[model samples]
Target: MAKVQVTSADKTKINTYTFFLVSRMDAGKKYYVVSELEHLTLEADSSKVSRDGQFVGKLVPESGYELPQNITIEYGSDVQKVSGNLYSSVTGEINLKASWHMLIRAKGVKASDFFVADHVKYQITSSENVAVVGTDVEDNATWTVTDCIIPATVSKDGKNYQVTELGEEAFIGCKKLKSITLPAGLTTIGERCFAGCVSTLTEMHCLNPVPAAFPQLFFHDTMEELNNSSPVYDCVLYVPAGSKAQYAQAEGWKNFGGILEDGEIIEPVVGETTDSTMTITCNAFEQATGYIVKVYEDAAKTRLKDEYQFDADGKLRSSSFSFTIKGLSAGQTYYIETMAVREGYYPTPIIISQNTIEAKTTGTATANEGVTADKPIVCVQDGEVVVRSSGEISVRIYDLSGQSIVAGKVTGYGSFQLTKGMYIVVAGDESYKVVIR
Candidate 1:
């Protein structure tokens, strides 16, 4: 057992804080005490604690002190004693805990270990600097790489693989990629990055322009048509839903033949009654593979009910698909429009001419004979009037006619400013007194 004392020294005064005494100790015998100290300085004066500040320290018996043994110094915190032997008459260990300015060592992380998942598929990370040179990727195999600049020197050894690039592709003949996930930061796709891959590829998510130097193999003839028409791509390009119109108008990206808006699934327009057969026709000059027709009760709220697929020859003629509308109620009105869906062509399938039709009774035979009075001939908005028949026809201006006027090829809606008035509208071999207001 031993006795120890703790103190605090101010500028000019020494204060004895605490003391403890040990028993059963001889004059020649001695003991060791371990102490830990912490300093506290006051920035402002407090009511209970002195403004002069205090020096905190702890003392513990060191009779069994050993290397790497926990020595309890304060009531809450403890310190470890590392020394091997403690002298009986040795003074207590002193720990100085104070605030001192010192520079800290810099911290860093080691480079990540990277290796290609499959030799057929190269893997590149954001920090990689190597070039990928390998065999042609299998058609279904997926090649994933990210955040690396793949120089033009790299070449794809094989075909029909999926090549995802987070950066620009400066190389040529990487066409084996059947599908690609373009990086948002991508700025350009070098020429032929996807050349000779058209047949194997089903889609391309291009975020930037197809480099001008790239060969036509990168895209089909239909995709190249975007330069003259809209920025429509040749293949099915899936974009963020609801961005069809925006993407359709993007520079060098328009003319996506079939721009499907978000959440919209393009299917063939199936007639309501499975028993009722309908014919779908298109006037597209190019050959198409499928035809999509939309059936709607109201023009504004339209949806796809059915889709008709066809072979290449279907594009040249009126391709007909018949479906019986089994449960459709007779006399219900419906609208129909058709378009062409073909491979290597875009803005697909063409938007077929649309019209309204009515369902008839199952056993009844109905024929569309001719135009009746109720459905009079009318001019379409922004459309010109042309007379195909060459026969004597009577025509008169609604408000400016005294005698009967003759009718021929009349254009511009027949008047500059059509106001609400009674007009005598006549055509070859027929006459109809009409009123325009």
Candidate 2:
């Protein structure tokens, strides 16, 4: 039979505290045994074992002896033994498993120990270290810190600082920012950073070339700055003298057109004039080819003035045509409107005159001397009347019931033929009874 010993060692005493039979078996055959023991130690070097108490090693039996057959090992309260034949010429080995428990401790300082001030301008370095200056910040104002990277370089002039990035919203909404000096190394601007800043930032100095994606909202120097859609014109854009063409092609910056140079002012288009003579002069008016000018008393009236064509120079010579408004009664008001016309093309018409000049008679006359009515009851028809007048004069007719019969206006010597009726004839404020048959 073969016998195995189990022991528990205490490091404090440097000696074994418990001992028991670990396993037993008959020589030359295999056997199985199960046992449970705590705090067991092997004769091998203990330091090689893990802190979890697991053991990995071969257990060798005496030389020239075979391991027991049918052998099984387990752990519990007592050591166990099983029998089986073992060969004397064979050697055998065994292994055990166990575990150990341990505790861990933390090292060094906490994050909260490092503090940063609130509500102040900070110049963050490439390493992300932040330094606060003060808290008196201007509302909606942006400030840029140049040469942000540590170990920054200086220009030959030694007067300017270079930076690689425009900090987020560095100059956004600075309603009072009249000017800004940008570093040459700047490559990109952040978003929504400069909106609502139209009132401020009259000028921006780009010491370096502007980045390709320079923000569109940034109103840099250009003519569009002065001609912006806003009804209020307040500022002028000034760009590098020779950069007008390049900036004009830039996307958002193009809104300010190119920078204005000396003697490059463009005059505005003048509107057409409206006067009693029905004459108009628009400086921008082009000499419309095959175009005609039309004048009308009113849209509802089919009557139209003669059409007149413009000369090659677009000048409508006063003698080219004259509008004589006939069928107009003295002391009567009339409206006149004029329009430019071309076949297949209709531009806005120029209102030569609206609600203009009164038509007045040239001569005066006496009353009743030229009035006659053959019949008493005046029948209204197509607004005409008949009356016998002595000498050149004007005539108006009214029915017997005192209602105006003929609203037609007339002047000069004439025998007025009207529908049969008795009517009151009125000539320039003088009334006379007459009959038309």
- Return the TM-score for candidate 2, rounded to 2 decimals: 0.24
**Where does model 1 exceed 4 Å of error?**
1-178, 183-188, 205-233, 267-271, 274-437
**Whole-model lDDT per candidate:** 0.33, 0.33
Task: Indicate the TM-score of model 1.
Answer: 0.29
Worst 10 residues of 1 by lDDT: 100-109
- Candidate 2 — worst ten consecutive residues by lDDT sum? 99-108
Off by over 4 Å in 2: 1-122, 125-138, 141-161, 210-212, 216-235, 257-437
Q: Write model 2 residue lDDT over 352-405, tens digit each, in one string.
A: 111211112222222111122211111222233433332334556667687865
Best by TM-score: 1
* Candidate 2 global CA lDDT score: 0.33
The most accurate candidate by lDDT is 2
Clashes of each: 43, 45
lDDT of 1 by residue, 329-412 (tens): 334444555444654444324432223332222223352211111222222112222221212233333334655443334321
TM-score against truth, every candidate: 0.29, 0.24
